[model samples]
Target: MPNEYPSLFSPAKIGNLTLPNTLAVAPMTRVTATQEGVPTETMRRYYERFSRGGFGLVITEGSFIDEKFSQTYAYQPGLANVEQATGWSPIVDAIHAYGARAVAQIQHAGALSQGNRYRDGTIAPSAVQPRGEQMNFYRGEGPYPTPRQMSDEEIIDVINSFGRAAALAIKNGGFDGVEIHGANGYLLDQFLTDYTNLRHDRWGGNVEGRLSVSVEVAKSVRCAVGEQTPVGIRISQGKVNDFMHRWSETEAGAELIFGTLAQAGVDYIHVTEFEAWKPAFGEEGHSLVSLARKYAPGVAIIANGNLHDPVRALEMLGDGADVIALGRGALSNPDWPHRVSGDMALSTFDRDLLAPIADIKAAEVV
Candidate 1:
């Protein structure tokens, strides 16, 4: 009765906001911003073209929340200052004009911040050195520096910074909402994982304790943004530096994490994996999206990772993903949604395309 990709074109709800379709441009780091962390024209055109090409929602690249400690790369944008928000305003307006909702992905880099210039030091839940060297693409070199453990006061400061950044993004930059970056082994993810979070304090010990920082930040951001705005968190079992990682605990560990966030009243949870449709763990048939649906039925589920194929994307949507996020898919074809809907030929994603930056620049959009 329905087209093969009907759900992909159908409207979906995240909190009180309704998107025209289930396709979203996943948050990616595009080092096109100014050194001072303001959005640039190149970045504007990059996102604008995606909206104009018919994507339903465009999530901006991760924007650091705290100037002092959250910055991760040179030219990475920030929402900590008014000028940064002002720079993002026109880009958000352009996306809205093209009928797509724009959501800012707020982040704190923690120990993975090799390009951070605000301070000479890095801080994490614990002083552990992360598993791998920084990606050279981000201008990072050599082994990662050992980070200082975050103090209780510093933790609170980071949480408040997320709240302030969310408020600034929506109230000042005109983003439709904010998505907290609790994924990709960033600051929030550092707190979520046991290997990185070796603290015995309230912040870490077990799964529940590891999840406390993210939960608190979500509550703070929600309170700052209010009930009308959609606030979600992006989470993953893996990190950029370590892709093969998984929860050391059982599946119940995931339930506890998702359950706790849903109870905190986050509008949605974005779950990412190397393959969106595959089972989350060894021999387990349930995918992360299904797991999220099971754990947090009341919350919207956004499934990301390797969803470049139209058939696979449709299958994932059918499998209970309220929204499908495209990373490299969108990277290659800015008109991915339109092309798939119309059965048009699509471009292939080249790893070389990610050479200097994450976002596709105007010159590279052939």
Candidate 2:
């Protein structure tokens, strides 16, 4: 059969790496790693399934960058050391065997940390308490603890950790690219958020100040990986806790955020929203994906949200996105690309797949 969604299945590029298609599996937290942050055999199988299912690129779940405040959940994978990074080698080999490019999404959890084995407390740009309660699924209860404000020295160390982690990911984990987790209310987003970052120094106060950490992290990752490796950053307006957040500066903010990251030498920018097609600001404004394309013309744009529907996915490609990343859709239909191209019915996601704990189930491995 002729490919109905030509744009969605077309070949694409990010940096020097070429993808089989524009379909990518968005990074998702499964909490299936070992206690010491090492990637497990189960994780290898779980990620390999996506590649086998015809995904052009597979971005791993947010792996903690350092042993300090970067870890957010228990059993979350990390690239902090050689052991953890080396543990991912088999998984990278598996993905590559199936001809899918893999990217490691490195992150710092910062203040939203519900669990961190290495640290006694959390740290952030400021000491403000986050807006919402901890997620029950991630094994948390009650309001979040107010994080201690990070010192200047600590901030510099955190920046260095990102660079070191990126290097580790490529050197040991054998990843094709690195993605800085700057979205979803993580450490980078905490700095970007106005309420969370109230400092008057160079790292806070204004939008540029708030965005400084993310841009710096981008530069750090780019430097660590060099000019040839694909480096990207994920940007979003919503938080895992507070889902309704939006940029106050609107389009102007979008321009600054995307442009600065592109200027920092990132090869791509991944923009995600609750709904990728919806307007970013008011009822009729351009979507965040469109704004990203407008500002970062030279960089690849990956759009993620509730873009499970092929029509919506194709529409986004027309809007500005070079690739469509699916979370729930990919979870349900791992062979989404094959199903769409072959005109097969896609499966619906079952909530039981993530019930009780969001670990990778045995049934999902095959």
Candidate 3:
């Protein structure tokens, strides 16, 4: 039989890097690293499984970018230092051995941090307390602490850290590309969110001002990785703490956000939503993936969120998504691409795979 999802198995390009297929593995936080932020052997096998299963691109979970004020959870892997970056070399090699490209998603926890080994407290755009309580899965209890506002010098440091980490991922870790974790209510997303960021300076206030840090980070990563390396930024309106949140500016907000990143020379924009096919703003609005394509026509778009279904996954291509990234779906069926293409039955995702703690389980490796 002809492939049911032809678009998903087609070749695609993100910057200079060419993927074997448009199917990608979405970044999912798996706090299974050593306490010192080194990637473990288990992590290597875990990532390699996806590539070995025929994924064209494998994006690792959000690795902490810096030693200070960046790590969000205990045992979370990092690209912050040489040792951590070096530790990832094997995993990258493993992915490459299976003909899949590896991309590191570097992030900063900011005010939403539940645990941090480098520092005692958290820092954010403003001194506001983040909404919602700590995630028990990541190992935290009670509500989130109010973070101190960062100074001008510190803001520059945060931007520089991203560049440094991207460089480490490329030079030390051998990653094909690096993704800036500006989404999911992290530090960059904190600045983008209005309530989370209440500053009058150039880093806050209006949409452009609020997104200034993201734009600069994208520029910094692009500069650090050079013109040839593929550099992308993940964008999402919702947060791990505030899932139902929406951009106040809606489509107009998307125009500025996506347009600015494209102008900053980002090769791709990864947009995620609870449901990939649903409208971004309201019943009549376009999906966030379509908006990203509309605003940043020059860059590739990776659409995440509930796109595991073959029908929905194929529909996303028409919606302007250059790639379909799977989270829970991949966890359930690492060989989803091969299965879909061969007309094989797909497996159902089990919450047990991530229950108790979100760490990588032994069963997942084999």
TM-score of each: 0.97, 0.99, 0.99
Name the best candidate (by lDDT).
3
What local distance difference test score does each model get? 0.90, 0.93, 0.94
Compared with the true structure, what per-residue lDDT tens digits does model 1 show for residues 1-366?
Answer: 225578798998999999989999999898889999999877887888889888899999999997799999988999999999889999998899889999999999999998987899799999999888987878888888999999999999999999999999998999999999999999999999988999999999989899999999999999999999999999998899999888887579878988999998899999999998988888777888888989997899999999989889888887888999998899888888888888888998888877765544566433
RMSD of each: 1.5, 0.8, 0.9
Pairs in clash, predicted candidate 1: none
Tens-digit lDDT string for candidate 3 (1-366): 237667788899999999999999999988999999999999999999999888999999999999899999998999999999999999999999989999999999999888799899999999999999999888988999999999999999999999999999999999999999999999999999999999999999999999999999999898898999999999999999999999999889999999999998999999999998899998877999999999998999999999899899999999999989999999999988888888899999999888789999999888
For model 1 the TM-score comes to 0.97
Q: Across residues 1-366, which tens digit of lDDT does each residue of candidate 2 receive? A: 328888787899998999999999999999999999999999999898889888999999999999889999999999999999999999999999998999999999999999899998899999999989997777878999999999999998999999999999999999999999999999999999988999999999889899998888888888898999999999999999889999999899999989888888899999999999999998998999999999997999999999999999999999999889999899999888888989999998898999888899888897
Query: What is the alpha-carbon lDDT of model 3 when measured against the actual structure?
Result: 0.94
lDDT of 1: 0.90
